[model samples]
Target: MALITRLSTQSESFNSALRTLLAFDASQDESIERATADILKNVQQHGDSAVLDYTQRFDRVSAPSVAALEIERREWLAALDQLPSGQRQALETAAERVRVYHDHQRAQTWTYTEADGTVLGQKVTPLDRVGLYVPGGKAAYPSSVLMNAVPAKVAGVPEVIMVTPTPDGVRNPMVLAAAAIGGVDRVWGIGGAQAVGALAYGTQTLSPVDKIVGPGNAYVAAAKRRVFGTVGIDMIAGPSEILIICDGATPADWIAMDLFSQAEHDEMAQAILLCPSASYLDEVEAAIARLLPTMPRADIIRASLAGRGALILVQDLDEACEIANNIAPEHLEISTENPQQWADKIRHAGAIFLGRYSSESLGDYCAGPNHVLPTSRTARFSSPLGVYDFQKRSSLIHVSQAGAQTLGRVAATLAYGEGLQAHAASAEYRLNLSN
Candidate 1:
């Protein structure tokens, strides 16, 4: 197994290279959309009954009643206490970091008074209840639990319910323990598109949530997209992607290993390196050749590297950042002499690892940043799920008679310009009444 793709600034073709890694077909087809729509409709209409049926069919768990959806505080306490002190401490530390970061993200309510006694402001209020979906089949991300729940908590949301797939009909204890640390109010043994439906529509045993946040497989992403109008979702994510910017400061072995880190995530995952040094690229290729053969997922990583991954030689740091912005990788790592300089030029990226010492995995677990990131270039418009995701904003306007009279003419003029006669008339009538 070897890292087989390489491109130089003079010869690189992004168009031809991009076409090869378009794997998994985007999880949205007529069948999937129709199936998700049906599930959403059924859940909305039948509530708990539909939820139970889907849970049993998909998760193999029997959650027939709302009582089953609630994970008792006692169960949570038991799970937390059972962990060794180190693990417990780690969870606590991660929780504090998340709490602190999101606390800073907490929005302040603001208002402005106009000259004519008009008051306008924005009011930030946390949602009453939110549901978090933690991917459970292949792995349990306690960090995800912290990232999702801590934000809601910081936003002052009253309830945060967690749902994870229990394929074997049992939730992971570590997940429960993490939930305890993060102040999640409930845990449901549900998974897949059905779990998303249950959260979006509310089942007999569960209340409909104001928002749903977290990552899941293609089925889950499709379900979230389907339910988006009825409830809010963070973003539709794809396979993990990482772009490393290096001038060969680190060993090629380290560079190659970092590429594999994201590649093994899935066959479609992308691992790209942008550098100005050709010899460094050669060394990294050789290092990949030696290191990839030893990994259990070597075949998967190799396919990912050959297809989606690349080593690109660029003209300089500025060009490298431009390419990174164009790609907008989920994780951007700057492994250069002055990484911060290169990092400043990155206009778009999901999460950035500042230096070689800052591994992407650290951010995934305990670096205090949300691991859920924008994927597939959505970073240009989206962001990592955070405290704001569980909150809603409402604009506030208070106008006295004098204020209304002063502003009504302008409002009417704008409305008339937009061909909205009724809107113009309403404003004109208000101005007349005030007069």
Candidate 2:
């Protein structure tokens, strides 16, 4: 039996089949929603007490107060110090590369004087504080800590508060080390919807954050959705996805493992391969089968492949690029002789990896690009999380006396035409003063 569905563009039912494959039921689970609502409401009203209750109940870690859950700066430094030399070096290297990449994304305030001496520009400013929720316990993601916190720091955020669940009260040292390296100001041993609520609505111990960024379980996602108006959020991400456009030139095993990289994330992740050669697709399938037994997460990879993965056959690379534009996958790998030529044709993808050597895993860990990409075709209109997400722009306008006289007349005319008498009067008053 085949591990993944194989589709041919020549089939009459191809469109319908493709739609079915792409469709993901993103609808919130009713039970989860109700629970999340209750948690958020409780946390908002009761503050630290509510967070403490939920933390104890969910994480099974009793704390005297929310303050007790806070990890000190010394602890973070100690964690970094305790790490094996190799692991510490790797973390530092990844952090430095990420910092360098985000440094290039920083936006500076700019202003230009017009002919009439009117100054107009935009002032770029970072948010005061940001909340980073990292998955903890068995699912420790130190890379996520660097990805989220480092960008916020690069944007010049004054403080970054990190929250992670410590199931059975065992903290992951790597996560703490990452917090230290990424310049996270505070760390709290809290998780789920309660942590999100605490970040959104200030608790007695934990002050509210300007924005919340990071990944977590369903409850955390739900909490972020509910509190969007009160505080900004990075994105309500869907399952991970990877789309590889191969020209049958890359090695089959390399392509197979690349697909597995995303599939191992969870059962809902989608991995699709598009190539002109049918025989190459078969070879990749053979490789997947041969390699499946070796992976520790074989069951998860198998389920993910069986559920949402595909081996697509296109007429040529052009058709494949067209289909890729429509899909707008989170991670797009163009593996061919001249990969950049095909990449130039692509307009909608979270991140484009060129050539056979560029693997998605490298981007996930340390390729100097953000791994927090738009998923489930959201890449068509959205972008990957970056330093931009942590910063905002304010329009600057300083009109000179000469400029006001000239601009106010236009403003008054438009305001009057729109039946806004007060607006017209205000502009006309400015014109009169300028005169």
Candidate 3:
């Protein structure tokens, strides 16, 4: 009945065992990669016809033309109008909070004049268009529609095109409602690698987007990888991750369910708990055994917990903080009395949930901050998606006549040192007083 792993930092084998527990093989399947490559090529060469054909083959939804796949702006609004009162209110509230949070992230253009009258700064502008890919099949995540599209719209992206797969050609009203509330310019009921390809390569019916954002299955991830250079893409998200550092003060069932929140994501998802109290770890284990049977996705949660989840006894709260930084988890919960102290000590995490009341589930839903965060320890280098993702910056330089004389000589010196005679001559020509 040992459903999950138990470890101790004091054990002689702890380091090796920790490595084994933390290891995740994120390599894409060769078959998926090849399939994605073929799809991308076909979409590139054949345009709308290729997309229509693939939609029939992959998603099993047959449309006469790719244009028929598009869900018009009025339909998006109708979807919004059809929503139940509570669901509609929730979507509107979440959208407003997300928009308000991103408004602070907008970068402004600035230029400063030098003593020689040289002007230097940078200009920031929003992307013209963006593509959002929402997963549709078993579930409809209206939250995802808000999370992806709201930030892009807040960044002032003019057009947002959305793609979601509908098996049996059944559309989810909430997703469309979210797209409407999020201000998406267009919506296309299509998904898988073909949807990604259509967005990346631009078919006759769907215009190519500057960047593609949102989540999908393995095939979609591979297609995004193949088409990265042609267009920008959000992070290739891995399985869900949650690491909680508990001080043993919170109720055990609360912590147990928190672990289960991420574990239900799938087998590859990881959920780990670090605590200084052995008794608390025991209490959590008991809670997991008692509560897990009641979960609807009990099999998935059990598989995820047994495969990658762990509960480790650390030396102290300080030691738990150190290990948390090393893990660089996607979702970190500092469940303690003085959570801020431990939070301040932490250096890497996609998002940090502080105190006993702050749950990772809240961040996934109505949180003002972004929920689309870096995964698989990518938080160490990459950041969560934000308004900055949809904005590009260009450096501005206006050199005065006197400023050019000074800058031209410096440029000539560097060009001469690098042995570029043409570059040196070009700089020298600017320095010359031509008649």
Candidate 4:
């Protein structure tokens, strides 16, 4: 009777059907690619003039110069003052926690000398500047400002420039307030692929950044993909996804709400549940049907659930964990008596929410871990955004007289084998100089 699909491991055609369900076409739309290419070229060639024109056309913010789009520090503070006391305190608290957590992840430089006087070490340096993209207007998310900027600042990046689309010249005060709280260096009222192009290519007033982070709609995603090599980008993320494995001991309401948390992101977002107990699966399904009418975004939840969401009955919790590894969801919740037991089995997931109390929403806001996670099965190879993403490492090798003689022979041999006479001679010359 439930709108969502119900699958069983006992079913004959489960494997093929599940594969069909999991397949998502990540290829960019050709039309979007063409449009993004044109925008990037315009910004690269015309610089600020192109930015101003696009701002006028898309966001309807027609400032005489791109410089006027900058929301200065005092303006950020004024926006902070506009917030109610409760909202201000909450933003500050969330920012402080995020800062504290990332402080532990900061990397430092180190070196050591050997008996031969050879120095070997690594030097870590923070990026000079980073650009953050936030969905502006009705989609304004204050949490994004804190999540993206705080980590870069914690990593010692000198400047953090944020670009958010302000359709019709309207700005969200809470977003600006979060920028102030997170210590963001600059805020610009801009959005869409044009905003992405400005960040990637740089205009007259806005300097290009070392990297771009944050999320946006389709056009923004396409732009990020195109400008990847010119400027670093975080990742081309897909829809929100959450996979929950429960032992059926936990309350059905807890699991149902956790599933809904991700479903409300959008219609394409995925929320799946895999459990060993069939009765518990039924209970959760009933709970979902009962609770659907209560949610303000019930319409969205309904479409997402009917379209992509699923409830599966697995052979056992072990089998559930196996399937979870294959899916590699962005957010994985293990709600059971022994969450750690299953947690130990998980090979891939962007972030794991263990126990009923550890909801995904907490990670999205105040929880210590970064909420910008790898989505769309990228967890197999990538990881969550953190201070490390804003930092770079350079290897240091200082070969001494004794060390060079030893290192030269090895280097010369490899160089000669590679058919580069100049490289071999360079090492040979160094060897003779030291001898």
Model 3, runs deviating above 4 Å = 432-435
Instruction: Candidate 1: give the clashing pairs.
Output: 48-204, 66-205
Candidate 2 per-residue C-alpha lDDT over 190-209 given as tens digits, one digit per residue, 9 for 90 to 100: 99999999999998888999
| Candidate maximizing lDDT | 2
Judge candidate 3 at residue 407 and give its lDDT. 90
Instruction: Give per-residue lDDT, candidate 4, residue 345.
Output: 95
Clashes of each: 2, 0, 0, 2
> Which one wins by lDDT: 2 or 3?
2
Better of 2 and 3 by TM-score: 2
Ranking by TM-score: 2, 3, 4, 1
TM-score of each: 0.92, 0.99, 0.98, 0.97
Ranking by lDDT: 2, 3, 4, 1
Local distance difference test, per candidate? 0.85, 0.95, 0.92, 0.90
Runs of candidate 2 exceeding 4 Å displacement? 432-435
lDDT tens digits by residue: candidate 1, 1-435: 335677776765655554554333564678777888888788889887887788788877776484675668788789999999999999999889878877888887999998878899999999998989998866887888898898899999999989888786666778899999999998877777888999998877788998899888767888999889889888888888999999888888888888999999888898999999998898998899899999999989998898788888888888899888888889999998888888889889999998878888888878888888998888998898888787789999998778878688999999999999999998888775634
Error of 3 at 428 (Å): 2.1
Look at candidate 3 and give me any clashing residue pairs. none
Residue-by-residue lDDT tens digits, candidate 4, 1-435: 356889987899999878877778898789988988999899999998988899899887889898888877887799899889999999999999999999999999999999889999999999999999999888889998898999999999999999988889888899999988998888898888888889888888888999999989999999999899988998988989999998888889988898899999998888999998889989999999999999999988888888889999999999999999999999999988779999999999999999978888899999978989998889999999999999999999999988888888999999999999999898888786635
**lDDT, candidate 4, at 258:** 87
Model 4: CA > 4 A from native? 432-435
Candidate 4 shows a clash count of 2
